[model samples]
Target: MQQSNTYIIVFTAILTIILGGLLSLANQGLKPMQDKSIEIDTKKQILGAVVDVSEMSNQQILDYYNGTIKSIVVDYNGELIETDEKGSPIVAEEVNIPKNFKQQPEDRQYPVFIYHAEGNDDAVEAYILPMYGTGLWGPIWGYVALETDLNTIKGAVFDHETETPGLGARITEKEVQQRFENKQIYDENGNLESVYMLKGESNPESALDEHHINGMSGATITGKGLSDMLKSYFSYYQGYIEKVKSEKSVASL
Candidate 1:
């Protein structure tokens, strides 16, 4: 009996080490692939915000993505610079600007990407900047694409934390994301009016009649959090946006 018990203990110890080592090895081997997948997914999401995704298959999306998307890094003055694939500055501290940009809005990199839809040079579209923030549980991130006006939001995509699985997590769903499609971001007078998240069955027409989206019903907190996140980052781009608007106005005249 003693020998049997000793054998059982030895077997358990060996099994534990073997399982741990296997897990460690798997994590090490999969890390690069996992990161690559995430980067691809992020790029896909950013592109999706600018183009129609339903019309193309995954591979076609990727092919068009590789062929058309030109990523560039811009400084506070909106001047382009050579940078990483993510559009961050090559300088170490310069890249760190976005992390604390809410306090020092003038020091952000301002990533920009231009896409030529359907391989047509005439159909070029631009997406600017990416946003990340804390949701109720974990991290929430999104991409916002601005129209040439820079006031009108061309499209937006949002993903979020580990809130109540089906309820709060719905903020990340496709249907909810679709609500921002072609949503106007400014009043008719062209003032900078950001989108808002309404509560308690608030109809957009009645509540935000001029320019805002109705908030998610049960996930109002998430909706408000998203609004807050936008206000923070969008304000940073104000100078650049105003310059674009001024250029458009001048061209029209």
Candidate 2:
């Protein structure tokens, strides 16, 4: 009995050590690949937020992103300043093109992608910006675009957490996304209305305007959270948007 017990203990210890060593080796070996995968996925998500997935495949998306996007770092006030340009602080730089812009609070730069499609005339669209927020169960992120007026939503795409599967996750569904198509982000009076995920069902009568939409049933929290996220990010882009609008207005005049 004593010999058997000793043998069992020794076997257990040996197995534990072997498994631990293997796990450590695996992590070390996979770290670089894991990081690369994450980077690629990030690029893919950003692209999805900007472009129609049906329009491009994985490799095509990568190729288009590399070709069309130009990153620049800017300040909270939307001033384009070179962080690493002069001998100034290396902290104020933001990516203007296809770079990560999550450095400082009130001093971060965001990505802006341009997509050119051949339509009747040459149709040029700018993928305005992206923002991240907390959802009911996990993190929620989206990309919103603006028209030349900077008040209209050219397009948008959202993704979320575990949620309630068919309920909360519906924010990323095709039917729900279609609700935001061609919608204006602001009211006729230039109020920051964003987009509303209406409760129950969408009623054209109660919409903020012709562009407002109804929220999904059983997913009120997720819908509301998404609207709030849009509002907050729009605040960040207010300066930039205003500048663009002003420039266009001046051009028109």
lDDT of 1 by residue, 1-253 (tens): 3578889999999999999999999999999989777666766777777776667766776787777776656655655556766975474213433364554556566666665665664455665557766667766777788876576677878777576676667767777776776776667886667777676446746566535777777777777778777776676566556666676689789
Q: Candidate 1 — what's its lDDT?
A: 0.68
Candidate 2 at 13: error in angstroms?
5.6
Mark the 10 consecutive residues where model 1 has the least summed lDDT: 89-98
> Would you list the clashing residue pairs of candidate 1?
198-215
For 1-253, candidate 2 gives per-residue lDDT tens digits of 3578889999999999999999999999999999777656656666665566665666776676666554444456766655544666443213332233345547566545444453312355664577767668877877676666677677777877577798889888767876777787778788776776666665667454545687878888888788777777787777667766786789779
Q: Rate the local accuracy (lDDT) of all candidates.
A: 0.68, 0.67
Q: State the lDDT at 232 in candidate 1.
A: 66
lDDT of 2: 0.67
